[model samples]
Target chain A: MNIVEKILARASGKSKVSPDDVVFANVDKVMMHDVSGPGVIKVFDKLQKQGISVDKLWDSTKVWVAEDHFVPSAEKVSAENIVKLSNFTKRYGIEKHFKYGMGQYGICHTISHEEAMVMPGDVYVGGDSHTNTTGALGAFACGLGHTDVAYVLLNGKIWFKVPETFYFKLNGKLPDHVMAKDFILKIIGDIGTDGGAYRTMQFGGSGIDEMSVQSRLTMCNMTTEAGAKNGIVEPDQKVFDYLTRRGATNLNLIKGDSDAEYEKIFEYEGSELEPVVAKPFSPENISVVREAPSVELDKCYIGSCTGAKYEDLEAAAKILKGRKVKIRTEILPAAISIYQRAMENGLLKIFLDAGVTVGPPTCGACCGAHMGVLAKDEICISTTNRNFPGRMGHIESQTYLSSPLVAAASAVTGKITDPRDLK
Target chain B: MDSFKNVTSIVTPLDKVNVDTDQIVPKQFLKLIQKSGFGKFLFFDWRYDENENKKPDFVLNDSKYDGSKILVTGDNFGCGSSREHAVWALLDYGFSVIIAPSFADIFFSNCFKNGILPISLDEKTVEKLQQETRPIEVDLEKQTIKTLSEEISFEIDPHKKKILLEGLDDIAQTLQYEDEITEFEKNSKIPSVL
Candidate 1:
């Protein structure tokens, strides 16, 4: 069995498992944010009305909460939702709630790794689709809906039809100008949006071994865009060191067997990869940076769990250090920890010096929720995943998805400029 | 949750692929804590103009799909986000059955939990159903969708079918296996984490 297969098999108490086999896997950790937190609370309410027990969770310690998506309170309603989330957490005795404005609050996926909430060999599930991001840590991480999360809260387990694995092998190191974002976008482009549906996308090879844990995270984060159930890389020394620095201890790494099976294998030469962007309306609608549509960009947003990591910010700062942005650009870190690191390392100052507004960490405009969404007919280059119609703002507003480097370079020129093409 | 009743209605057709949850219920409306009122916000951008006037060109505004209990759309419906609110909005708007060529994995699981029956059929069958102007009958007991001209059979997991048929609360149903779950936990060796 592969890493995902072995993890799921162990969690479910199965001696062996195969793709499409249904197993009720015991969950190690679960997460819900303000948006899904309230939704799960509502599910609990409905369950109570149905005469089911909603008194306590199976294990409160395994459950964590985050306040993102509409944090800093998008409005009175969102404010009330935050209050509801707080009350529910207090009532349930969930101690790991990352409260907004209190400290260390940010996107749920970011907090998962930053706070070391999940570890390798754990079956982690969250209410948001991008929960797949944490799979980069070698955990069998997947996203669930509010009701499913509500179920996990009470049952500590949920049924899953094990997914077939798609092994992605990268040979050689990525070019300096190309980042994980470009490679994932290229994969999504080659395989349509539903190509990975009900399957796992696993990364491995010389390139993955050479990549940083943060870069591997960026790779897994966008697996949601391809409709994958989860994304993973086998745990290794780099993963152990990354987690150990983040306070994780007693780590037990999980790896695939020598005879592990994959449904398919796809290989890419990292040295031949180039910066790419996903055009408007679909993540699979991708084009190389040099061949991208030449349009005036209204905004450049460098934020979201997909981007805005410390390394992502460093990449952007390197591009923006001695250059001024020609458009309205925002650099919102994915977490307060990342925010502080960027601040301490002078990445924030470089962004501010480059005529960019350094904002607080939040899901923000990535989901079209507050904090500088695009207006009608506006165009943007974003480091966030997804560019579907109305994804970032008005129905007609367009977004071109690119790496932080490309977004920073585009910010400098107010056009879709590749970092290599930047003046 | 309501038990699955054979639905009979004029099928609403959304001739678009990858109809994401964001469009089904946009981010702005997600602030509402209650799930009941989302019917008004379903397809907020497509169903209405900026000033909140109805857009005549959208399929929902054509009056043909009024009170539609079944929505037949292009492939990969409900493709983005794991929001259950999308299913809530669809159900609140009176949709009980959604027929598509494919659906995003999370959204597909969400439908059964919410008592919405999402059926996957071949593209040609879905397109043929989409073009059917007459009211269609979807019978879960028989596992068949009957239009005026043709009857199409669909497949579903027996367990999922039983859930929709019985309107069983998922949490309550799972609790019945508490002994099994506890035994699994006791016997399993879980790795330690930070």
Candidate 2:
């Protein structure tokens, strides 16, 4: 069995579990965000009216609530929703709830990764699809719906049909300036958005072993756009070391069986890969940065759970050094800790010196919630995932998804230019 | 969630592929927390121009697709983000049936929970459905789709089918194992990160 299967089998208390078998496995943790919070509580209220009263969450300790979408109150309604979520957390004694203006909160995905709340062999679920980001920690994490999350709150378990695994085997070493964002964009291009629908994408190979935990997180983070239920890397010393640093005393690493079966396998030579970008309207529509079409941008955004990591921000800052951006540029750290680290390391100063605006650690510009909303016919080169129409603003506004290296270069040039073309 | 047994209506064919959740319900409109009141904002970007006026050439704005209950779209529909608001927006816009060659996994699962029938027909059949200008009929119990010219059979998971047919939400289904969950919670590892 693979790591996903082993985790499900253990959670379900089954000796063995195979693909397509329905099982209600014990949920290790259920996460929800401000955007999805009211929906969960709405369903919870309906369930309570049905006489299924839950004074406390089924397991108060096993729940995580975050407020990032509408920080500092985007509007009256969103503020009200935050209040409702705060009240729910208070009533249920959900101690993990992190509201805005609170300490050390970034996007829910990055925060969960930084906190190491998810462990290997655990089955985790969150209301947001990007919850699969935690799978980098070697957990079977996936996304569920509002009512499904509400059900997980009432019961510590949720049903799943064991997903077939698709092995993404990477070989060779990645070139400098090429990051996991380029690797994943290339993958999404090869296998279009629906490629892994209802399946698990188990990333493997010596290349994965050598990659940083940050790169692994970015790799698993975008698997949701490919329609994968979960995207995971086998637990390695890197993950263990990271978790240990975050104060995990007893670590039980989970790995797939040596001879585990896979539904299909895709092998790539990482050395042959170059920086790639997903053109507007679809993450699947990708092109190598050098070969991209002639286009300019109204802005360049370098933030989000997928892009605003310490390494990612550092890469962007190095490129932006001694150069002023031709257009608007935003650099957001993934968390307060990451923000403080960049500030201490002078990476934030590099960005600030480059005429870039450094912002708070929120999903701020990524979701087009408030800051960085593109206007009509505007275009942006961003280090965020998803280039869908109207994702960052007006339907006519376009966004090209690229690595931080490309985003910084594009920012300096005010166009979709290649980082490799820089002097 | 509402119970769904049957739906019959004229089809609205959207020809574009990879119609993502962002286009279904844009991020800006997601501020409205309530599930309802999203009908007016369905495809808000496409349905309206920059001036907030209705676009004349949009599919949903066409006179032919007025009051359309069934939508036939290209492959890989609902392909980004897990915003359930996308599903709510579609349901609120009075769409009971969506016929596609394929759907994003999360969005497909979301359709079932929201009392909407997402029927997956092969690309050939979906293309055929797009050409028809007559009423389309869907029967969940029979798992059959009837059109002006042909009848097509569909398959759904037994659990999902039962829940949809009986109008049982996740809470209702899990309530059956309430005692089991309570016991499991009592025995499992308590979260330490909090």
Candidate 3:
């Protein structure tokens, strides 16, 4: 059996399970952001009115909430929603609430990783789409709607029809300057946006063993763009060590059977890849840098749960050390701890000295809630996931998705320039 | 959730593929905490200009397609972002059904939960369905879409079909399995270790 099947089988107390099996699985952890929390709270109230008053979260210790999207509330109604989350958290004795102020917590996905709230073989669900991002740690995680989240809170269980598995076998090491973002972008290009819908994408091959946990996280984060139910990699020593560093005691790992069945398999020769980017309005609209259109930009954003780790910053800082950004640029560390670490390493000073605005670690401009909203006919090259129309701001505005390395380099030139071209 | 039986309504055709949630209801309009009143904000960025006036050229704003309760869209509709607001906005805007060749997994699942029916057919069938401006009939009991030209059939998950036909939300249905879930939780054991 695949790891996802193994985990679900155990959680549902079934001796065996396969694809298309309907089961009530026990969820390990659940996360939600301010943007989606108010609706979920309303659902809870509605359920209560229906005579199912959820007096307390089934497991407050296993639940988490973070106010990242619409942080600093762009509108009064937005702030009122956060107030609702605050009132609910306080009343329910939920201790994991991360409010908008009180030291920004960035994206909920980033903080969940920073907190190490989930362990391998865990079945996790969140209210936001990118919850699949956490599966890099070897958990079976996926997104759910507000009512489903309310259900999870009420019962600590969620129902799922086990998704068929699709394997992405990354073979060799990524060539120099071509990183995980580029690699995943290329794959999404191959398999159009809906190619992986309703399926689990599991990573394997020798190349994964050599990649860092951060790189693996970067790879799995964008599976949402491919319409995957979840994306995951097997945990290794690097994962265990990172767990130990982050104060996690769960070191036990899970793996798939040597000959697990996958509905389909796709292989990639990673060493032959080029730095890639998704063109405007579609994450599946991919182009390698050398062949990319002459796209110019008004703003470049290098942040989000997708690519905001310490090393992602280091890669960006290396390109912008003494260079100045020609366009408006924002460098957001994904979490406060990452921001503090980057500051200690002087990456913040390097970016600030190089004409970059180091903003607070909210979802900032990614969701277009505020901060870096674009104007009519504006163009932005962002490291954040998803490049749908009007994703960052105006419907007329354009957004290009790329790696942080590419984002930093493009900021220096005000176009979608490759990082290798920078001095 | 209302019991879904049959519908005969004019279709609003959104031909663009990968019609994401952001395009369905952009983030700016998501500020409203309450889900109601989103009909005004549905496709807020595309339906209205920067001056807050309606754009006549847009399909939804066209008088010819007014009172459309069914949306026939291109492939991969509602692709990005998991906001259920997108579904609510469509429902509030008086669209009770959507037909596309394919849909993003979450959005398709979400429609069943919200009492909206999402029908998936082949590319040619969808193209044919969108060509006519006439009202089409969709019968949930017979599982067929009837137009002047032809009658097309599509498959749905049996479990989801049961819920939708009964006008049941997932919670109401899952509550029926309360004992099984409780029993599983009580006897659960970690599977990480060999």
Model 3 residue A377 CA deviation (Å) reads 1.7
Return the DockQ of model 3.
Answer: 0.66
Name every residue pair that clashes in candidate 3: none
Q: What is the interface RMSD of candidate 1, in Å?
A: 2.8
lDDT of each: 0.92, 0.86, 0.85
Q: Which residue runs of candidate 3 sit more than 4 Å off their true CA positions?
A: B179-193
Q: Write the per-residue lDDT of candidate 3 for residues A188-282, one digit (tens) a residue.
A: 89988988898998887878888888888888888888889999998888888877888899467888888778999898887778898899888
**Once model 2 is optimally superposed onto the true structure by TM-score, how far is the C-alpha of residue A198 displaced, in angstroms?**
1.0
Off by over 4 Å in 2: B177-194
Best of the candidates, lDDT: 1
C-alpha RMSD of each candidate structure in angstroms: 1.5, 2.6, 1.7
TM-score to true structure, per model: 0.98, 0.96, 0.97
TM-score, ranked from best to worst: 1, 3, 2
**Considering DockQ, which of the candidate structures 1 and 3 is the better prediction for this target?**
3
lDDT of 1 by residue, B1-194 (tens): 77888999999988899999999999888877687888999999999999999999998888767888989998899999888899999988889999999999999999998899999999999999889988989999999999888888999999999999988767767767779767767877754331
lDDT of candidate 3 over B12-96, digit per residue (tens): 8888888899988888777665666778888887798889999988998899898989899899898888888888898888898
Q: Which lDDT tens digits does candidate 2 get at residues A269-312? A: 98899998999888999999888988877999999999999999
In TM-score terms, candidate 2 sits at: 0.96
The best-first sequence of candidates by lDDT reads: 1, 2, 3
